[model samples]
Target: MSDRKSSGGAFLIAAFAMIPLLPVASCVSEGHAGGAAAKATGTETTSQPTHATYSCGPRGTLTVDNFRTSVKLVDPEGESVDLPASPATQQSRYGETPYALVLDGKEALYMKSGKEPVTCNR
Candidate 1:
């Protein structure tokens, strides 16, 4: 009876240990889905229309697309914002909040709502 109790306790401990991993697994699966969707949306090509994706923790994902004449940004909520390509720094307002995205080489700095800029790499 003692041995059985010990085995059951060990099993419970193991199960408890695995609880934290569940959320991590779900996040990884969600990230995979996001990647697949981004690719399907033409964000992984190497042509005239270039694309880039950045992960911003709780702020969510940021996708940038550079067309021949214009630039497009997609926020975490799948909302699209348009901006011109003339300036290296692009600023826009989403809803009532203002945001800025600065592109330098293969990196981008995203800032909004008085929060520190989030850096994203290509």
Candidate 2:
């Protein structure tokens, strides 16, 4: 019984570790959806380098009135990147939409509607 419990505990720990990595993909993909291009700017050690970490996965895909955004990547350390808002893109969407951010050297990307990031659909 003890052995089984240990195995279950180990499995739980492993599963939790994977949770953070999931978001990395969303941040990168979101940039592509809006026609905003992003490349690796550089890398920094520690979580403080970027403001927040965003990644691509089920939680990263966000949909609004006529547009959707996905996160394709984000820094492993949970850093945030800022992209300048494009007037043309916002106009097409009907208002001033927040720009998607990919941080941690493109390891994560996040889709933002305003101040908060839009959650992924699934």
Candidate 3:
């Protein structure tokens, strides 16, 4: 009787262990629908866009709409631009020609063509 109880407990433990693998297995078998975009931009988006207004002190406030693969940036003067995700060794970065935004937690460093980099906080 004790042997049967141990076998049942082992089965139960194995069943619980497999639960965490279910989502990963489903994704593997079904494949990701946005896999191509994800690979191109190197961003896996699982939530909605985050909108924030960052205070840059002397440089003024910057309105940022951060998306999965792109970031829409509005300068203090109200000029707006959309930047795509760029590769970074650490921290999140988005760039488009004369504009680049690097986000580190609640702070962001904005760089443009003819201006100095501006540091802003959320």
Candidate 4:
């Protein structure tokens, strides 16, 4: 009967020891959704990066880096234009000329200040 009592005591101690870890285990299982809770509690969490590339017809290619929150366009002339993120487009201005990039379906549209829009495919 003493052995049974000792084992029961040990079990109770083990269960008590695990109580503090339950919150940590739950946080780990919540994944990114837990980040919202941390933020709500005034904790800071690092954001993940999202990078995407789009090929536009003859205009060139566009690369978006969500981490830096910037967009870069490469032209066939090997010139690169760094554009700022806009509400629904990436836009850049050089001298008096303005350029805009928009994505539709699997294609991208490149528009200059006054020229016709160029279509590019992925």
Off by over 4 Å in 3: 1-49, 88-91
Best by lDDT: 3
Per candidate, the number of residue pairs that clash is 0, 34, 0, 2
Model 2, range 1-122, lDDT digits (tens) per residue? 99986775565455334434434534454655443332221212222132333333644422222121222233222433323323223211111133443232323323333233332221
Task: For residues 1-122, write the lDDT of model 1, one tens digit per residue.
Answer: 99986775565455434433433444444465876646544632332237778776677888987763456888666768775533322121111235545555555555444444455555
How much lDDT does candidate 3 score?
Answer: 0.65
Off by over 4 Å in 1: 1-49, 86-97, 113-116
Scored by lDDT, model 4 comes in at 0.46
- Give the runs in model 4 whose Cα sits over 4 Å from its true position: 1-68, 88-97
**What TM-score does each of the candidates earn?**
0.42, 0.21, 0.56, 0.38
Q: After superposition, how far is residue 78 of candidate 2 from its true place, in Å?
A: 28
lDDT of 4 by residue, 13-59 (tens): 55444434433544454466667656633421122124456675455
Cα lDDT, all candidates: 0.53, 0.33, 0.65, 0.46
Candidate 4: residue 10 lDDT (0-100):
69
Point out the higher-scoring one by lDDT: 2 or 4: 4
Is 1 or 2 the stronger prediction by TM-score? 1
Query: What are the per-residue Cα lDDT tens digits for candidate 3 across 1-122?
Result: 99986775565455344434433444453255556645534542322238878898877999889774788989866789998766422126677676777666577677776665667788
Best by TM-score: 3
